[model samples]
Target: MRNRTKSVLESIVIAAILLVLAQTFLEDFAVLIGWSWNIRKILLFTGFFFDLFFTGEFLARLYTSVYNGRSARYFFAERGWVDLLASIPLLLLSSGPAVLALLTGGAAVFALGGMLNVLKVVKAVRIARILRLLRVLKLFKQIKYTNSIMAQRHVAKITAMTVSLFVMLLFGGSLVVSMLGLPSVDQVIADRHSQTVERIVSEMPAESREARNWLAEMTDSSDLLLVKRDGTTLFSRFDNRYYTELFGPSDYQYIPREGYDFFFDMRTLGAIQSKDNLIFFVIIVVFVLFLLIYYSPHFALTVTDPIQVMRKGIEDDSYNLEVRIPGRYEDDDVYRLADAYNRVFLPMKDRSRGTTEARSSLLDFDDVKGLLDGE
Candidate 1:
């Protein structure tokens, strides 16, 4: 995984993710606005390209990671596990059993492919359910769930749907994951401020008039303002923000998490306004988001690639002390790891190479000394 190649692959996958998520979000909006834009067919068609690209990217990194000596533990950690669960099976849909079926022309592959096709049908149903969620939003006129969710009376079904959406679709299929994951907006917020959210929820009362007043303010103005424990201020636009349940439903039907409440706005017009924001604005936003999601995880690749190279080098007995990680790796824990490996193994390798030569030299010296003694 050269830096350049790693970057390109990440860019591709991230770009694909954004495109898919945008399509997903847009489709939701389109349904809300009652537009029949055929976004579904278009999204499905585009999904194939994304799936193929990501599948290749996933396999490449997996091989490189395994090749480099990543332990089962390291590989199964948060980052690796997400890549494996989210990316690999989706990839296998096209490459794994289907391809195997073609190559071997075996009944097992056929059975596997048939089962996968069934899964695909289930996936379509889930997507349809996702689209149906747009309808549920219509129920939130003032502050209520038209339908009971999770059998809880006050819980907005839409709120429940969003939570269920994230979880079910996470495991539902690759397409669902990409469609939901790409926004990466909520994901970033959750990760960056999870502790803050917990703290806020714990400290704040379930019936604080101030919090209730704030929720009213959020609804009246169509935005939620949150100042975190660190005093880092954050806000969510009613249009841009998606809502889900954080806890048992009470005054918090649409609160997505403890840290933030869903800024409810009835108009599904979205953040889009009349001739104000440009196409460039949207692109820049997407690009910035791409940079965030794109770079955060790929930084791990920098650590793993060098390890792989070292693994290959050692296995081949081609000891190269010149195997320096090209960029700034000095402060990285992985860098210290690689340095330590070289220190212990390289010296031993050098000694092994000198072993026979040293024996031969000693024999010559002994022979000379013996001859001199005899004379």
Candidate 2:
């Protein structure tokens, strides 16, 4: 029962890993593919579900190891570290600081701004899940169940190739896409500034005092300057900064409203376009994943099934000249091997029987002759 439970959980984990891989590769193009934004939420939910499941599995194993007084074995020998990694939703870890920054305001906002940059770097740590993909090697280990050594080798080799191909397409394609699709640093900064402008303008407070308070609450007090068309300052917040640095910095946006032109410096905004222009790569990955999954079983069957059948028949004493394997074609290597085996085996069996019968006949004649002499 325990083994059955383990098998079921392992199967679920494998399925989850595949789903996560598909989700990760295809997520960037979700909009292009006509999937609603809600798809992202669903994916996130499922991702959390799988993470929780893996975490529970890891804890269960840890508990069992502790009970057996071999907790070190679970951590080191059994790769519990992998389970721990696979379990963690590192992307979710940023939410705490984000919430705190939003609720607390001021210095916490700056801290969140720095953390946002750090999380951009944290996104790369997700590639570490590639190590978790190594868990899929368990599928190769299952090939050992095949009776034929040759069949096991063939299946394992192809399985490894298939896995390597999928991973290469996933990670390598993502890398190429990232390199090609990434915007220039200046472009990114400009985009972030534009986004910040848009957000602040859309959420601009109606009353002057309210607007000033909102601006102060949202970012550094001096980050925004509101000046009239006649160059008279209406609502200006200035702090310890040089006029040269504040006035003509490239990372600022200007918007002309009814009474005033607003100048806002981009000190609060983080990366707003982290993943864009990946539709082409997403399509390639989906197609490759589909093709691999669709044909892999057929390929494995073609390569391994014939050898397994022949080996099993030989073990069962069912393959011979009289009852040979029936699927022989000129181009079929496995059937040709069966044909060769039958020819050699039946000829050897016939030769051994013939020699034994001849020796028995000679002995029978000698015994008869000796009996007559005694008579």
Candidate 3:
């Protein structure tokens, strides 16, 4: 189980990384190719795949809980609820303010559900399956060879830490993007401003002075300026205040063109670039810390636990086959070692007991012999 969990976690991390990379590169390609809809479809499919995997994982967890005599119904119901809610985007594409309102409301609910799922994953840490690959990889170590029981315990600890670290990094990244980068806020503002300018331009009469004046008003408020087909600045009254504040100077010289053209601050196009690099660094540091925490407990539980159990069992002489190391003893190698020790010790204990009985008998016989001699 520990191995299985580890494999799944690793796969998830890899998939997430791939998804991020794809989004970064493909978006630009789509834009250049004028296939933006195709890009959206690809993103939708990726999301669907993620949803499917999450559902499967949730169900597997639920099954484990059921087998372990815990109530699985609650988890199943909650996961099902999330799936139902997430399915909304699959069907609905209503336009206008209503769609926006629905999406906003759904986003809040989805966030809550996602948080709950995260908590569930954390709670399930105790039962996470150990990764088989990690166990096999550890076999290369010559000096500090762990028994099967200890290996299994370590595997579980590693799996838990991996999942925890991933969750932490994911949330941390989101927090940074939200608070500092403000990508969503920026997007919203940009959308609203663009729509407002488009509307104003559409309402303006062709080649009219009033149209030019309205465009000039918008240019004052925003960095965007309207240009005519004859390479004339429609909004000659435009003050590029925002552009100057953002970028040192306007690099593009606007010649009066034949058709209307829009100009704005180009530097603000990819503002999240720096934030992304910072987030990457932070995630790497957090992951390293997680690894340290994961392996530190192995010294106590992996080495000490089995030895203590063996000592206790040997001293008792009762030979409790049920006596087990306190930590997770699921690793095959550790289990075999424990079995070997038990095999060696149990017979030794029996022989010692028999020898003690024989000695007592000999002492009794000697005492009888002495009595006979005295007679």
TM-score of each: 0.29, 0.45, 0.33
Error of model 1, residue 137, in angstroms: 26
Model 3 is weakest, by summed lDDT over 10 consecutive residues, at 126-135
Number of the top-ranking candidate, with lDDT as the measure:
2
Q: Each candidate: what lDDT?
A: 0.42, 0.50, 0.44
TM-score of 3: 0.33
Q: Clash number for model 1?
A: 1
Better of 2 and 3 by lDDT: 2
Candidate 1 on 3-54: residue-level lDDT in tens?
Answer: 9977795565556565654654553344344343244334434544544665
lDDT of 3 by residue, 1-375 (tens): 999978787676456534533443443333333343434445434544543454454466557667877644533422332222222322221111122323474353335437553222221211111111111111221113344545544543454445435544554554465446455544554565566556655676675677777676656665454456345556543355633432221112222222556554322332343244334434543543454445534554555566667776665655455436444565646555667666786667677887774232324566688799998
Per-residue error (Å), model 3, residue 347? 18
Candidate 1: stretches off by over 4 Å:
31-34, 37-39, 71-74, 88-120, 123-375
lDDT score, candidate 3, position 142: 16
| Runs with alpha carbons beyond 4 Å of true place in candidate 3 | 1-44, 60-69, 72-375
lDDT tens per residue, model 2, 12-62: 766766675565445434433434335543554554555566567668878
Model 2 segments beyond 4 Å from truth?
Answer: 14-39, 55-303, 319-336, 346-375
